[model samples]
Target: MPDLNIPVKILGIGRYLPERRVSNEELARLCGRSAHWIEERNGVRERRYKSFETNAFMGARAAENALADADVGLNDIDLILNASGTAQQSIPDNAVFIQRELGERAAGTAAMTLHATCLSFLAGFDLAASLLLARRYRTILLISSDIASVALNPEEAESFSLFGDGAAAVVLSLAEGESSGLHRAAFKTFSEGAELTTVRGGGTQFHPNAKMTRAEDNLFHMDGLAVLRLVRRHAQDFLEGLEPGLSAGLGAINLVIPHQASKVGLRSLERYNWPREKIVETLSFLGNCISASLPLTLYEAIKSGRLERGDRFLMVGTGAGLSMGGLILTY
Candidate 1:
């Protein structure tokens, strides 16, 4: 069994939304669909988009909010983690840039990045639990942000209408309490889903330098049907793997703050007998912000009072690796 005794607690959470909010009507015009058609399909009325903000820039903004909310001074941060799917640039990671923008006190602080696509936040949380418990760092700042709209294919309404731009951050600190920190965590990946959701360009596999590189290769693509099928097959096993962590079982989970992958993506939990009301959702407004979805939805849940401190909640997500992961914890 994995270590289920980590004592790190979430101090604060914050998110930053782009200035522009694209409504379904605006999106329908692009794809030649009716507003009602879009809404009925994705359950997304609108979503934000990054007009000029860079990924790292938006992440810095969200980090400031979380740090202030946590009542933590910049000097108190021991490490900065940029846990997102996309990078501001391919060269230097976004961690140091965020730390620098955060404030001078954040200067000289150790910085790094963890990439797990949409599961970035949960992956960071799982890693932080182990690292914090080991005393490797006193206070850690993890930020997840994505601007997926730029790369979306306009013709692919199913994918484009479901993606948005946003950022979310969380502050984690060591604390003493059985119900205040992570109790259990698990993740599963299926390489068979490698092509289900992909952006084939920008990497060595489809490098610009390569003669065969196509413009479509650089844009985001998704085999939505394949993704749904794959998840349906694995959903049960994923839940079963997580059952050992809960004090009770699925019903004992106060809330399931899931990734806002889609309308169907969230509803898919119904098959596992999860209560609809117990599932926290931000997809209708925020759509899918890649790595930012979970953290942003989590921020919404707490702000809306759907979740409370000491409440055992499960954070779950499915992403690019055809990966599935979850953390059973008390917020």
Candidate 2:
């Protein structure tokens, strides 16, 4: 028999959301469009918003809960990894602020930030698993958080209806013996489509000049048609590539967690012939939270008893940079 054991197991999971909730009708009015038009195009009903806090603060709330659920004290955590597209300030990194809020003992914890856009959390999972397997740490906290609402342009209907603010966290620990956990992880990218989805300004490519408008400086942009095509192709490719490594048959996989981009993106998976009962979506409630969406959806699935031990999960993520990744977990 294949050795279907994982060296690291999830100890706990948690999520945090902001106070403000913007419904589709409200957003449509702000954009001078009909709510039906927005819903037909993006399938977003509402999204959360944050007014006066940084991503680190939002992320820490979820991390604190995960640590509490795991029954692990701050001193017991050996590493902290933040996967966020939005950091309060670019310098010192969000991980430093998280470490500071976690206290002096936590300040000493090995911490770093991963910047893989929406797929950052999946990347963090791979890194944490590798470290645990290497005996580098006993307990690790992984946080996926972003506040895309901060970058929204009131003029952009596509963005305002989709992106949201939220955070999700998971605690992973090295397993002493055979235990259920992360089975396999893989990632791939296609930069050819990078321009199809991105923020146009603020990076090295386009430094702000006098001609640059506020819309260009602050808004998220995307070639919706292009992204739709690329995601459908890659989602299928990723799932097919991962099928062989899964110990359970396709029907046995318990949950399929995907980024909360749009209903269109989520519906594209239906063509893959995967079991319909396995998919869990939070798009209707949370909107697209970028890096935090997938994990937050998974956290909700677990909390609602939609997931359980011995169940298999397949997580797929894609974001700007035209990047894509997938991971298989046995829990």
Best lDDT goes to which candidate? 1
lDDT of 2 by residue, 1-331 (tens): 2233456788899888998998888888788888888778787777899977678888988899898878888888888999877787757888999888777778678899988999999888888888888888889999988988867766768767888899999999876665567776768888988888777776555655546545566568877778888876666556556666332335657788887778788876677665557778888878899999988998988899998877888888787878888778876
- For candidate 1, write residues 122-239 as lDDT tens digits: 9998888788888999999999989898888878888878889999999998887556878778899999999888999988888988999999998899998889999988877777
Number of clashing residue pairs, candidate 2: 1
Clashing pairs in 2: 310-331
Using TM-score, give the best candidate's number. 1
Candidate RMSDs in order: 1.8, 2.6
State candidate 1's TM-score.
0.96
Clashing pairs in 1: none
Clashes of each: 0, 1
